[model samples]
Target: MREDVGEVTTSLHRPTTDSSRSKPVRYESFEWPQQQQQPPSNGVPRSAWNRQHRRLSRWHRPYTAVLVFLDLISTLAASEIADVFLEKSKSGFQHKSWLFLQGSALFTFFAYVVLPLGWLLLLWTNGTYDRRYLGLGSEEFKRIVRTSVTVVAAVSLLAFATKTDLSRGTVATVSLCALLFILLCRVTARQVLHLARRRTGHGAHRMVLVGTLPEALEVYTAVTRSPAAGLIPVAIHITDGYAAARGIETPVPVYAGRDVLSLVREVGADTIAVCGSASAEPGELRRLAWQLEGTGVDLVVAPQLTDIAGPRVHIRPIEGLPLLHVEEPTLSGPGWLVKNLLDRVVAGLGLALISPILAVIALGIRLSDPGPVFFRQTRVGHDGRTFRVWKFRTMYVDAEERKATLEELNESDGMLFKMKHDPRIFAFGQKLRATSLDELPQLINVLKGEMSLVGPRPLPADDGDYLGDVRRRLLVRPGITGLWQVSGRSDLSWDEAVRLDLYYVDNWSLTYDLSILWRTIWVVLKRKGAY
Candidate 1:
């Protein structure tokens, strides 16, 4: 029997003496030999090994079943909706019999049986149900989109080859509706899984950390802070020598890295994350890979590269050696032109649509406070240029005068000043800040080319001129709402906000902008991290 120590179980190799059995074995007392030994090939029995494989399958099987069910329902419902809409239209679909199936009866057979099954088959072949990507990342969604396109292309080709007259409207509507439904279902499923991981620690990977004390600690801090990543560090192996473990403050038990395979087996860690320069040792990582071959364990390498998105990074293999090629940040070119055009167009339409709300806000501010309806502040913009950022006033006229007294209460670690409840904000101003309604006036700035719909938030000119890589954020126009705004707003530390802003500047894309805009809506609705 094994003893439980917090979330991690104690080593399984404790002595079975009477005294030892009665007393719990502490994690710090566990030790391994300095010399590395080859892992035993047949340490676990064949039946037990098979059971290990079955355990993983058991975890993902239910989720996969749920996905399959959802996909079937979505496809069938889409087909039925298309059939009904087309049947009711003036240009009614001409139904033809195929495979001994006329009229609405033939359409019903295809809708109820053929379309759903074919969609499932295509999705399966496209790896949409792969366990590795089922509830994580955007790979699953990409596969679903690719499969949808394939379905449309395949149907068109088949109809042309057979010289059969299939209604163009039916094919287009069913395909589009099915794609939307599947994508929605996937997004919902991912959110539910993330919630479970955050609240209950369910579906988390039990991982062992391997590297020097500092590197391992960095990885540990990152994973623990992000519960949605689902990495639970159970043990640490100091690769710089066990002496490096001295004076370290780690939440998990620390052990010598001389024999990683033994440590993993003792703790039952399903994943091993080699951090920082630990993999640089010649043949060390290769040897670890050989050891993990049939143990049903996953090996992950955490490269030092941080905050870079997937589109910017690519693997280029030359003569069997894989090298990472990071593309330069897109600061100019056709993409920037498109982004600029989009910003102006969106801002123009938004201002037109919400002009009434803007007027009401202006009136409320005018009545609530004795000041200008709009506040203008000089802020650093693209290429170090300064511009007046406009916003519905959310503070009293004397707010600036009171700032000197509130300086000591500022909680931010960096240049920005932040307070959860500022005394200068009136009752109505607080509501405006919470719902971000005060920011609606920035559409005018975007339309005037002084800002963007999505980019780094402009900082006050008093924040000082940015130097080094931080200046990269000024390559693009400042925005009304950005990554920093959606992520945490005033709640984030100064360094974190800068890091998020820099990341946005380096990895800007149209799709990325769209995703940020979508998340911004939710952030505003939830009023998360708002002052």
Candidate 2:
């Protein structure tokens, strides 16, 4: 209720899911100061749910205040550092010197008070400090950029409107430095929060999932899979007779829907997340909201929407009744042209930047084997068009010919072939493969317009594994590294690989591409699931 983003509690004591029982119930004593049921059994001195929620509620404001303080300090430090640097530049900054001499007090006020306060105001106006945009996602970073630009625009407007004389170089330096510092500080803060969440699910809300068996397990799996910036499912409240369904296998309890209030009290739930299946009619849901008025728990109603990106979603309120609107995915036209342009430019520069490394790798390949330095294979690209994809040769010359002999040793599913210790690979090739240096040659294909820097990975042209309705993958050009590459590579199941590829195809955007490219660096460094 205080702020929206996150909150949670911790305790080793948790509920157990009983498969055979009608409802998995915990017998923690439930009592009110004055109760009428069963002679008022005494409650646990302090339930985990209550303790966790209380901590979440109490610390929400203080935590947000700390974030705001960090922003202000970062802004001031950047301005001061920029001031010191600009004082040394001597690039027509005589105006600053004149200001110091003629308006020393004004200069002090401008540097120490006005600019910093103005920055804070601009950030607040731009929603940089809003709880809804504070943690995770590029929205926060974008807001910071917007705030900085808005401040610059305002300054330029003032200069034009009032003939205000200012040092151009100093103003530019301060603006650039402030923007950089804000981004750096925000990124660092998110890293710290991520580490905290991963280490211990702190700053995440404790959730009571209210849904039927199938629907409840969906939410449960989603929350558990990504614990960072995720809801911690404390308990599952199933509809009247569906509690006995064996969908869930967690220590989190399953309760009858009628026992929602008691379960919430017992588990110290901070939020009640009502999934579409369990969120009765509008009238019933409204009444339920009334029933939950002062419980100190946030009520969230989730519509049954899946796999839709935030940009395509709009919530329209017609006469105070919320209606969901979903825009179809953008698959072509101007955006696609931009994605292609970025891919080519970045790939061109990438190939040039890494030419030295490529040469070294080529030398190693020549010394290791007498075959060609590049391995060219036909792979399907945009619109099912086939193009030759290049990679540093990591296999022996006759490896393809010997494929039949090792067919029995295949360890991978789908059309793809993978073996941890395949005889086809050269000794030096293993290191190259493990380090992902073998894929560097694909940048040439990327530069050639046959591939993109980010998209679904291209499979072998003759490999018809994903050619059904999943041809949706070929709607865009293939990529050497993509959702599949970053999401565990060869370790991903066939279904999982297809899912990731399709998700990329369906929700492609410039921002999304950049995010994946950023993630790709970490994934490559770790060599997770690579072989």
Candidate 3:
């Protein structure tokens, strides 16, 4: 069997229509057969194609197998532990005769065999083993939790329907322990996978980006920014016709989108990411999906929506058409009220717990510099209200007066001023800033309800007023630390900082605040991007 295809490389030169400007423009073009004109297949045997497809896409199988083994161990250990606990407490449930087993034998049979098998079945049925959710995002954990809930509900319903005297304590203990153990195993597995991807690019998808030049480049940038997400671009398929005419330069080999299936096969790409309006033609996307049906290539559509978190977006299928519904941001309401209440409570407790350290730092600051122990500055707060933000003095008393001399040395690219090594910061102050202990005094602001435990960082009043959409950051109280601070603090560009702040304002929740606070601890310990 042979595949019929044609490839041609040609150089064309066209002279200008005007005699006064008769300079010829030269360009290179490569042409291939149209989509319908190309061969239906690569002429490989079906068996050989199956073998090749498995070889190309089974890279994650070993990782998935490891998770399965871990889950098995977790469930078995949980059952045995529950059995031991029940036995020691003299509260074991009596098992009546069932087939050839009775009493202790029957209990052991169910505990050792039936329980683990049922747990694994539930996990499989809940899609816990899906490769897409394995090593990224919170979906894997969420699925595990959902599986655990299902197990509890199923067991309870079975006991009720059968009128079996099932021990409530046994079920709760086994379910809770199994959930914890499996979650721990998954966290460890995810960290290992992330490390492998970062170090060796292992277990990553070989992605082919399909879109116009600009849209493809945008998707490429976003995916490549976080290499841990594991969508590696191997080729580009330009959907628009003007790419060749304008001679657009791309990071990877560029092909006309007329034959994306052929392009994927040629590049050995396992994922095709369609970006922006690449499939604007009617039924074009569905046709592409049809072409990729059994070839083991995953088709992913990258919508133009950027920075929208998953919780706010929902897919509602109406008449077999999926419509994306975006819930409005939780700027106010009961959830916001809960967030504000928790902020004050956590702040108050933090201030009380860290009072001794605060005093020691204040004394050290007074001894090292002749300035006030606390540095107070007016900052724009919620609703554009001006609040006096407090921080342990980390600069000289005359730091404000010396600002003029260092204005020429500004290293930051925004309204803010930042220098990696500023003469204004004293020795003790550098230590304070390095560990972010300087920001601890802001807990007082948080306690006073002028700041939040997690939100956008408040800007100094003198540091240019917020303009345009940037003012949205003021909808919530400024934070002691936020996405901007944990992301890179002084290292992020002005626009990037604003983008993160706006993202926080649009996605604020108690869970988000807690995640930020957790990341802040790690960022502070690493002392990354700090002066």
Candidate 4:
């Protein structure tokens, strides 16, 4: 069980895991145009919308059913495997197997029936099939983990109380294996639904955002981009306090404050999402919920805190007043130690595994340019300390001296000076930059403990435009690849780049880091946003 928890840390994937680029499709200042621009009639009848909601809401029953089947299969498979596995251990160390075999040398009938039934009951009663966890698989997956842990704890206590001999190794193996199968079932199901949505726009909950322009647009971008979340915005209802005097045009239908309910009926929007500004008022939302009672429309409230994930936020109700608590991010903990250790191991393995390529790159760089093979520049590190970040030189030795002459050609955002076709690099150097081989040598800094395998990109120490509140990102070691690497590399805007960096620091986890690493593989290969 310890090894199971350690292998795939739940903290690896935070509850608010969103990997998409979340920037909104903003327009000129919204003028709150008079006419309610209805959704273009796709001829998708209103009955189709109701069927979609039914599928989304009740998907959990089938989801849980699949879980039960997978658990049964996992139990049978683990029994066979564990019996064989623990047999060797038994012969070697006088251990017991997991099957609870009777005198006939076969499993007891109760093992097959009682245990599987218990699993289903525990899972169901523990809220694994809750409506809120249906489409988006994060919560559903988490509940499975919670159920497995709690059951294991209960079994351990029962064994101790009854003075029954329980094979710790066998129990751990079956629990972990069963969990693996259950999650696999959920992942496969969610992907099927995601494919349905992508191909046909089926099984998604249509939404209408009601709030001020800027904040509403933020929510709009999030829901629209994250189709897997099963929330899609079909219309907008701008409220007061928006910059309505200025002209603005939304990509979708726009509605007035009074026409939100009518717009929902017009488009069959199942979710009435109330975002920031006047629409988020308690009295107003209560009234909205009251109106939505029998209409089958769900009311969702998105808080002003953007980009923060679920684990950090807690709702505490005291005297009927609910208060939100946000846990501050800390860099010092056992988790940090695990991350630090993982950084060195992976970086070392990475360098060793790619030694021949590193050598070949070294040879190519030396032959291409009659200068240093390595580029070392001062970069801001954790807590604002400066370190010489290493990289395979992908430019001429006089790259810095040529900066002034190329200042007029800068195409990058903020204070970042970049040019897609910069003349400063040697001929072969451009390929390295394009393929991201130029940053490979930063693995050395990672091994040297000056950087991490995944964290914010280490920028030049003198880059001042984004040095304000973003300096908090310096609280952890910089990385060779990060949200920036998989996000858009150098193609991201100044604000987007900083936002990704800050988000990484705030949502640091082994799972998040591994995801970035995995995405980096394809992002680097395709060179999508590389310049």
List lDDT for all candidates, in order: 0.77, 0.72, 0.77, 0.70
TM-score on alpha carbons, each prediction: 0.87, 0.83, 0.84, 0.75
Best by TM-score: 1
Report each candidate's C-alpha RMSD, comma-separated, in the order given: 6.0, 7.8, 8.0, 12.0
TM-score comparison, 1 vs 2, better candidate: 1
Tens-digit lDDT string for candidate 1 (1-531)? 112222221221211222221222223212222332344443433464343232321346767888899999899889878867665653443454231222457657777787789999999999999978876667898899999999999888887998877777778888999999999988897788788888986667778888777888888877786687777899887665556556656688886523556556567566889988876753667666756654567788876767787789999999966678999888889989998999999999999999999999989998999889999999999999999999989899988999999999998888778899889998889999999998999999999999999999898998788988778889889998899988888888888888889999888888789889988999999999887
Candidate 4, 414-495: lDDT as tens digits:
7688787889988789899889998888898999999998998887987653457687788889998898778777777878
lDDT, residue 269, model 4: 64
Q: Which of candidates 1 and 2 reaches a greater lDDT?
A: 1
Residue-wise C-alpha lDDT for candidate 3, range 1-531, written one tens digit per residue: 112122311101111222221122221111122222222333333454453233245657888899889999999999878877676655333454221132377677787788788888998888888987878777778889999999899888887898776667778898999999999998889889888888988778888887776888888987887677877898876655433525555677775523565555556667888888765543667666655544567888988877788899999999977888999898888988998899889889998899999999999999998869998999999999999999988999999899999999999988888999999999999999999999999989988999988899899888777889789989999999999988888998998899899999887777788779878998999999998
List candidate 1 stretches off by more than 4 Å. Answer: 1-58, 90-106
As a TM-score, model 4 comes out at: 0.75
Compared with the true structure, the alpha-carbon lDDT of candidate 3 equals: 0.77
Candidate 2 lDDT over 165-238, as tens digits, reads 65666678778888887788788777776676678766666788877756777777756765556467887766
Off by over 4 Å in 3: 1-52, 91-103, 242-249, 318-320
- Model 3 residue 335 lDDT? 83
